[model samples]
Target: MASDAVTIQVPGPHGDRDIRVSSPSRVLWPEQGITKLQLAEYMIAVGDAFVLANGHRPVSLQRFSADIDGEAFFSKNPPKGAPDFIRSVPVVYPSGRSHAQLVIDEPAAAVWAVQMNTITFHPWASRAEDTDNPDQFRIDLDPQPETDFRDAVRIAVELRAVMAEAGLTAFIKTSGGRGVHVFAPIEPVHEFLEVRHAVIAAARELERRMPTEVTTSWWKEERGAKVFVDYNQANRDRTMAGAYSARPLALAPVSTPLEWSELSDADPRDFTVLTVPGRLQSVGDPWEHFADDPGDLSTLLQWWERDLGNGLGELPFPPDFPKMPGEPPRVQPSRAKKP
Candidate 1:
């Protein structure tokens, strides 16, 4: 370790390991006065839960060059000087290209990520071994303009009911912003496209039940004040903030897991890096049993087929993706209408 850096011992699958955190006094979250060492300690405090949610999965690191509010970029590939303990797995991207991405297998690896200046952890829905199939289906409840967290929360409640009808168990989490994320553990029987369709099915159903408050509109102009169900998040290589990952927002709020009962009264600002460690100690991880008894996506797929038969075909994928086979035009709705 350098004279300025601090070495902290972290426990992982391989037991205790010494990890050096450079620039321990450098402020990462400027508003909160959170230092680099404080972020590393936060990872250590929630290490087990963080690993349970993010480990053994290919992840992209959101690294900051200076402070959280400074220059930032995503590091999908392993940067130079990554330790032997840090591992990488090759995963296919939407462009038909393949490359190795970093995977955090234990708590110590996460601390190492903080040392690399990672503020948020973006883990894939699939495990590192089965990179082709997703065992988890994710839905991002993104609140559009004129909408807020409360709107997203209401849509999440409706989504939970939709999942229940399909025999799937749903888990809730904050998006570390003005949105929410809902996940359901599923057997790894379907590929990314199938999972994406399953998410679309769920989102369409929620929209049907609450047309005034929810929407699956591919174009932003049509979304209005509704919460946008970002089904595209299920696409291969796409990721969400890990359950216990910290966000680079003003308060350094964490993307936290929550029991259904707490959603109604929950305030996202309370779940920050400074407070989450103690919250985990007292309340325990709400997603401890999240992977138990993984459900099948058969019911959701059936819904997808039903929607197709009714004339709602494939929606537009992300613009960066190669134009998919049945996807609608990528043009914005207002512009597409122009002659």
Candidate 2:
């Protein structure tokens, strides 16, 4: 019996590769009726842009067993039976453990990921060649319960200013949800901890300037109806959805990049898998020159030292992480035993 499968030609740096996608008619996005084959086509449509932004990095594949709403898990390492084209790189986790993580180098690799039921691509801020020192400083502006995308936009606007002050050019993107991600191409001279501190310093500065609108509170209860500067995303092994990656939301939205001028008017819902390829064709990639000029962290690190002088110390790390030096208690403020 012949299974319902199809082979598609995906062009890459080497040449065109014939990739087979099984279950081509299987629906991945139930609401939009987007099938597995459509997802593969979407990857091919935006292949160049997607590879440009996410390639050469250690990427974690967000895979689903069924449709997006069903059981899902992250595949960091190269899964069994992965093609020779798909490579893996060694990375160190927060717990001092090291493991091999997958790296997507070209368009064919991305399409292959889609064939594996991968919905979202979470690439590390660092490149595969140098996993210890991050070449990108990333910040996630997460909207709280009462806040929304508009609030995230407002924070992103100010965050652009903040990055500019630190001598870094900011790139903006939708998180495919209500949040926004701001990234700056940085020199890979500093390790993840230093970059994390730099992010914290900038986050604190932004909070000071927009006290009512922004907060760096790691604990959700402490953050009101304000946008949270997710400083921890700058840490090692931490990642947000890479640009042009499709999120597993009902609408099948991609983490579309945006120009600063276009962000104010952009709506995330409009940048779905069904529409993003056309958007890419129309306006081109906003982050086309993202890595052209890399910025240093001198200014931001100075701010971190100054904040330290003012008694502003370390914040909580992700619960799964080992207890870091100088990190505050992991317990919630309300749950802590008072002296």
Candidate 3:
């Protein structure tokens, strides 16, 4: 789209040269097609749309180090620090909407979207809603020290089953890391605090059932053999923003919407920026039929109340949200809990 078009200079150890770039979405192959700085520009441009569409004020991007060769950004003999580049510098947009943005650099992005009812095309897709409302919840699992890849896969399969038992439709994807993110869509009617409570409750229940293989412990040392179930991501301001591909042989690191079955033995790298369009060619936008992803906090809040509460028998999550000064307790002061 014209919105992403830009004329920029590519910087390298040798020298800097002018590069022309623009795209309907992202500048997919910056090293081969553009430069590192150019690709970063594309990331910034698309991200700007992501912000405005989700109800945020555009802000400047922080400068960070990245290597762009003609093949991929941080791929191919990546600089020692390339992997953490995008995240190393914080991305801050002016606050207004409790906006959340999608990560598009991997197939996992699509997989996460498809499993939840929140496909990327929704007005709320790829953006955060209000601090109270979140349209989706993700369970990020960590691998253990001696755990083999198969063990990680097994953990994902079991987690899916647990989510199903909770009446949640969750999809799984390779995190492009040595883990997986299980996504579930909920009605956006509750505040961030309530949804996270429900998430914690649900995660805790799952851990209780699978103490041998799963854990809800925030501290790694306490999590023994079990996979670390990170429900803290459900917190209002917390984000798992997507990362664009910096290399080819490097994992296809994007948010992918996935089928539950695929979670069993799927390759996280199968879905890359290059392959998605082709998959669209045959499968035709895998998430084409779903409603667009939601960014509204109000909707998320309502969903939390309705889906997480129990009526006849047992219950999950506290009925109300925790008082402000939420998570990472040291950061925000709780007026309601002052000593």
Candidate 4:
């Protein structure tokens, strides 16, 4: 091992592998005074849980050149010089084009990602073996201008109840930003569109129950002062930062999972790359039971059909996505009304 890098042998399902971390002292999180080597070590501490949540899935790396706040870009395809141990799986995009995307199957692969200057991990809701059918249902609660984290927490609590009623178990996590993400483990029998509709149904029901606190509005102009349930994130190829993945914030906050009991007082800033390893040691992974019993979306699909009968239909997909069936005109309401 050279003086500038450290070599670690990480045990994986395949075998133990040596990963070299170059420039380990390079400051990745300047504000927190955390170095690239510290980030690599963090992966080893939480590797199992991180792999359990994100491994075997098509993942996109949010990489940086100098530091977390420096020039950043997303890497979907495996980059040049990728190791033989690293693997990729072919997935179809919204445009119907197929491409090979990277898959993280072990802790060593994640450590290698750290070496690649990846600060955040964005894993798909589906595994590599099955890109069309999602085994996880995800919802992103984004706080609008007038609202804040407290508001997002309240909405998350309500969403937990909603998931319970739908016969699904909900897990909560910070977005590594000013929002919350609630996920449910579901059977992979349903495709991405069905999972998306299930999300819409849950969002609409939450809106019905807490009209003042939440909004299902796709248009930002109409979503004032409410936490927008971003159903579009459930679509294929869209991803949220994986749990425990560090963000590009000045503080290098991580997307930490929490038990429902801790959410009320949970602060996203406290879960930084430097602090998370110790926190994990203290509490273990809140999502340790995440895969123990996967639930089916039958009840939620029923809600979807019920909403369809009530004249509520598909919401807008991301603009980049090809115009979907039953999606309303992509133009804004005011603009469309002008013509």
TM-scores for all candidates: the values are 0.98, 0.98, 0.53, 0.96
Model 2 residue runs over 4 Å out of place are 1-3
* C-alpha RMSD in Å of predicted model 1 compared with the true structure: 1.5
lDDT of 3 by residue, 1-339 (tens): 234644454343235434333332332344334333333443333332222222221111211222221221111111233222111112232233332233322222222222121212222212322324556656677677765545667877776676666666665545555667666656667655566666666666667677788776655556677677776666544444332222222432444445555566666667654454444346433233222542233333343455446431112212233434423432223333766
Q: TM-score: which is higher, 3 or 4?
A: 4
lDDT of each: 0.93, 0.94, 0.43, 0.92
The TM-score of predicted model 3 comes to: 0.53
lDDT string for model 2 (177-270, tens) is 9999999999999999999999999999999999999999999999989999999998898999999999999999999999999988999999
lDDT of 2: 0.94
Cα RMSD (Å) per model?
A: 1.5, 1.2, 12.3, 1.8
Question: Runs in model 1 with CA error above 4 Å?
Answer: 1-3, 337-339
Angstrom error of the Cα, residue 192, model 2: value is 0.3
lDDT of 3 at 73: 17
TM-score of 4: 0.96
Write down the lDDT that model 1 would get.
Answer: 0.93
Ranked by lDDT, the better of candidates 1 and 3 is 1
Model 1 clashing residue pairs (backbone): none
